[model samples]
Target: MAEVHGCNIPEDRYYWIEKHVWAKPEGDVVLVGLTDVAQSLAGKIIVVNLKSAGKTLARGKSGGTLESGKWVGSIPTPVAGEVIEVNGAVKANPGLVNEDPYGEGWLLKVKPSNWDEDAKALVTGETGVASYREKLEQDGIHCQK
Candidate 1:
């Protein structure tokens, strides 16, 4: 993991850095979640609303929405696919997103319909870390907690 400005960026997952989202490819499905930077910036999350399973989402579409003390925004899908499952734990306890954004707070599972094409646009490994670092620095943004 790369820690930039107090944000955790796991190298194992593909990142749509601009959206502050991560995608972890697991066989045919991808596990999606908000990045630590996002959760940190959002402050204490109070609510999470996710699209139900079987819902098809295009790349960059809003898969769900999150509300926090300081922010409220849609969670964009990094890969176009059918939502295979929603994280019940996150819905039940929005604080999980702030406490463990990359782990138990994962938003959903998606079986990508356009993996090859969509993946080409995501960044991962060392390159992803560097890219995220640059974006953070450029925007003067830092993670809190």
Candidate 2:
């Protein structure tokens, strides 16, 4: 799980450690979101700047933006892909990020151009949490969210 501040990380998703985003795969389709830890740290989200559906994104590039009280940052993608849908729920109620960061708060759905090549770099399962813990310690951040 993503142990940033003690939030529960969904076991099935893949994570981008640096960006703190999660990617849930469904065949060629992928769902994206800020990890539980990321959302908790961000505090309240006032607004989200989402890329349009059908927009093509490159691997490791920012797919959209999250404007929270804590910091304004880009949400990165693991795979180069075409976005199929942007979360309407989050658009209307930005606070959903805080309420359910891993589920209904999901930001987008994508059709990755290359799943295998891109997914290779992501962290999963227990190793993912270990990796996140190292990063948190390196940043001198304490987590109990």
Candidate 3:
């Protein structure tokens, strides 16, 4: 993991930095979640709405929406895929997104319909960290807590 302005960017996961989302491929499904920077920017998440399992999403489509004291925005899918599952824990306690944005706060599991094509739009490893760092610096964004 690389920390940029207090925001964590895990090297192992692919990131859609512009969308503030991360995707970690696990076998046939990919785990999706908001990045730490996103949670920090949103400020104390209050609600999480995710698309139901079996729903198909195009790349860049909103898988759902999130509401917080400071922000309200859609959670975009980084890859075109069918939603396999949603994290019940996040729905029940939206604060978990602020508490653990990359872990227990994960929003969904999706079986990608076009990984190779979609992956071209994402960044990972050192490239991702560098890109995210640049964006954070450019936007003057930093994670709190």
Leading candidate by TM-score: 1
- Arranged by TM-score with the best first, the candidates are 1, 3, 2
Give the total clashing residue pairs for model 1: 0
Give per-residue CA lDDT, model 1, range 1-145, as digits (tens).
Answer: 8899999999999999999999999999999999999999899999999999999999999999999998889999999999999999999999999999989999999999989899899999999999999999999999987
Q: Over the stretch 69-144, how does candidate 3's per-residue lDDT look in tens digits?
A: 8788899999889999999999999999999988899999999998888888999999999999999999999898
TM-scores, all candidates, are 0.98, 0.89, 0.97
Relative to the unseen true structure, what is the C-alpha lDDT of residue 61 in candidate 2, on a scale of 0 to 100? 84
lDDT, candidates in the order shown:
0.95, 0.82, 0.93
TM-score of 3: 0.97
lDDT pick, better of 1 and 2: 1
Candidate 2 regions with alpha-carbon error over 4 angstroms:
1-4, 143-145
Cα-based RMSD of the predictions, in order?
A: 0.6, 1.8, 0.8
Clashes by residue pair, model 2:
5-144, 5-145
